[model samples]
Target: MDLFWRYGFATLPVLVFVSFYRMGDVLTLTLSHPLWNARGYSLEAISMADGAVALFASMAGVAIGGWIAARWRMGWALVIGALASAIGNWVFAWLWDTPLADGSLYLAAGIDQFGHGLAGAVFVVYLSMLVNPRYPAAQYAFLSGFAFLLPRLVAGASGTIQKVIGYDGFFVMSGALSLAAVILLPVVLRARSRPSDQPEPAA
Candidate 1:
């Protein structure tokens, strides 16, 4: 605990990852049902868009991300996933109120799902990498626990944010927060490359 407190900045990638993941969750949870109701999309249409199109696309994206993670560094994968997520959210936000052909909503949902799928897989890998191998169990538990809790806590504010900014503005904020992950990529790569980056055993 003392060591972690002293070198907190070394945890940049994980913190950013949590933020990115939460933003995506907030966007999905806070708006999807309400948006469907406002847009007059039947529950069946919503099911198709979320359950079918998004689900399949997300699965495909995870597979692709797994392959890419094998071939490339985790940090790069994170950057790509973050950008894709941001773009996907932006696309949905842009199309929120526009008249949609039967296929358009599915496309938007698919894009968002694919981005999230990619990011989700890579995020776990990245957090694992950031933990000290010597204290793998405890460090991982700490990081993972904090990562999970903080995001959900902040996400609880989505309702309040939606009331203040409205859906479009809320979505735009989500996308923007996701993009903040991109800024930490260089730091992640730098930390990974350092000769002393190896994790030390817990005292």
Candidate 2:
């Protein structure tokens, strides 16, 4: 508690963003249902696109995310990662309306997985950045656990949300929700500086 406040990460906006960060990402679930039942895609095709292609795409994203975390401001990385994920969700919605061209399905799956990897990598780094240097293990455990706690619990409501909105609307909302993280970025960045960069008081 003392450390959280001293580090400037205990505020409502930061807490809210951390808790809900996974909401938009997870909404991209149920991929096989639409692909297999509605689109008539084969298991092999699904396996190829989601399993193999997605693995490579996600790896690429993770690599890029790592580079960005190393070089760039993490706030910008958050923006990039979140937008990629949100756009990935919207891509699925758009493709569902249009007849999927050959390879389009694979492309959509790849984008989603890539965004997942990017955002996930960036988020992990961000959490680590917030951990108190003196109490790395314990603080990180609390933060990491709290981060996913709400998102996982609220995940059950997704099916209900989908039932009401249908796929396209659901996906669009998912995209917008992810953008919420982007919107919160300024607040988070302003509230908390990196531990190493912790501002010193006037002499």
Question: At residue 16, what lDDT does model 2 achieve?
Answer: 83
Total clashing pairs for each candidate: 0, 0
Candidate 1: pairs in clash: none
Per-residue CA lDDT of model 1 for 1-203, tens digit only, reads 53255346665564655655546645665576676677677778788988989889999878887777777877677777777777777766766767866577788788888887877777767767766555678877876676667557767787898789877787788888877867766765675323345466478
Model 2 Cα lDDT, one tens digit per residue, 132-203:
676689978887788777766665677787778877887888888787877787778877543454556578
Residue ranges of candidate 1 with Cα displaced over 4 Å: 2-9, 12-17, 134-137, 192-203
- Candidate with top lDDT is 2
Model 2 ranges with Cα > 4 A deviation: 8-10, 30-36, 100-102, 193-203
Give TM per candidate.
0.81, 0.85
Overall lDDT per candidate, in order of appearance: 0.70, 0.75
